[model samples]
Target: MTDVIEREIKIKLDIDPSQLVRNLEKEGFEYLGEEEQEDVYLNGTVKDFRDTDEALRIRVVNDKVELTYKSPKMGKDSKSREEITVNLDNKESMIKILEKLGYKSSYVLRKRRISFRKGNFTVCVDNVEGLGNFIEIEGIDVKESDLVSFFQDFKGKFHLNGEPITKSYLELMVNKLDNSNPN
Candidate 1:
């Protein structure tokens, strides 16, 4: 099982992100962000053709995109996952790509995200359609000094102090996309 702990943070944005990312790179960090294309999902709905045991996702980077599938896992804190990602640009080709690789393509998306960490302080840039661009921070097993340092650095870059989130967007979607109630 993967052991790295995850944290969630959000920051408001006002400036051009391209220039923002370039500035971050010069400050001894790398930009990490991806776009996600999500297949329609609904809770307690019957589907013979789709797999619910996995959350299918697509991630886009600067040079290329990636196809990934994460197995559903239950944990004390929440469900965790193990993922496998491959470089590809277009998500529509995944079914054929997976067939060629002798794997299954259950779902696909076009997602863009940028994230990085300095020590235990982590930051993310996410762009999801209808949601817009967002900045997130994950303070994983961090020390007080590291937290203070990031608070200053990140606060200086963007207006922040947004709270953490426990539910993922899919979880939100399931409730929002509901067509019928489960008994």
Candidate 2:
């Protein structure tokens, strides 16, 4: 079991991914390859995740699967929180366990992520199935107080002038799906 404090700044990108990659490379950020990931978000039986501001999900990245629980945000402006993650070898059995425990699958998110690393921060450029492109800069070991400035500088380097998006990918995707299939 690994417990860590997660912090991230998310920016919804309207620009091309190639341009972002070029800018990042120009700044000497190391490319960390890419992977396709599918995340299955689950709802707790005892409480509503939205009301609690928490999340539980099983993330399947290739043959690896991880079950993660994320607590609510620690600050208003940044996505900082406590994350507990556990790796599982049997994804099918885990899914059955969760289902038997009354945790229903809420949504599934699919994305291809290109990662870059610089210092303690990992920057991921994600192309999501329904939400388009986004850039997420995250770290578990950096100074909490410096997140604002770091995000600003990172965005500045790419000439990104848009406001940062605070909503999680699951939240955004759920809302988008709901809106599209109106009853």
Question: Which runs in model 1 stand beyond 4 Å of their true positions?
Answer: 1-53, 73-79, 88-90, 97-114, 138-162, 179-183
TM-score of each: 0.47, 0.94
lDDT of 1 at 154: 75
Which residue pairs show collisions in model 2?
none
What is each predicted model's overall lDDT from 0 to 1? 0.50, 0.88
lDDT of 1: 0.50
lDDT, candidate 1, 66-121, per-residue tens: 65555554323323445555566675576555456554543222335677665666
lDDT string, candidate 2, 50-123, tens digits: 89989999999989999999999886777888999999997779989998998888889999999999888899
Q: Which candidate achieves the best lDDT against the true structure? A: 2
The numbered model that scores best in TM-score is 2
Clashes of 2: 0
Query: Cα RMSD (Å) between model 2 and the true structure?
Result: 1.3
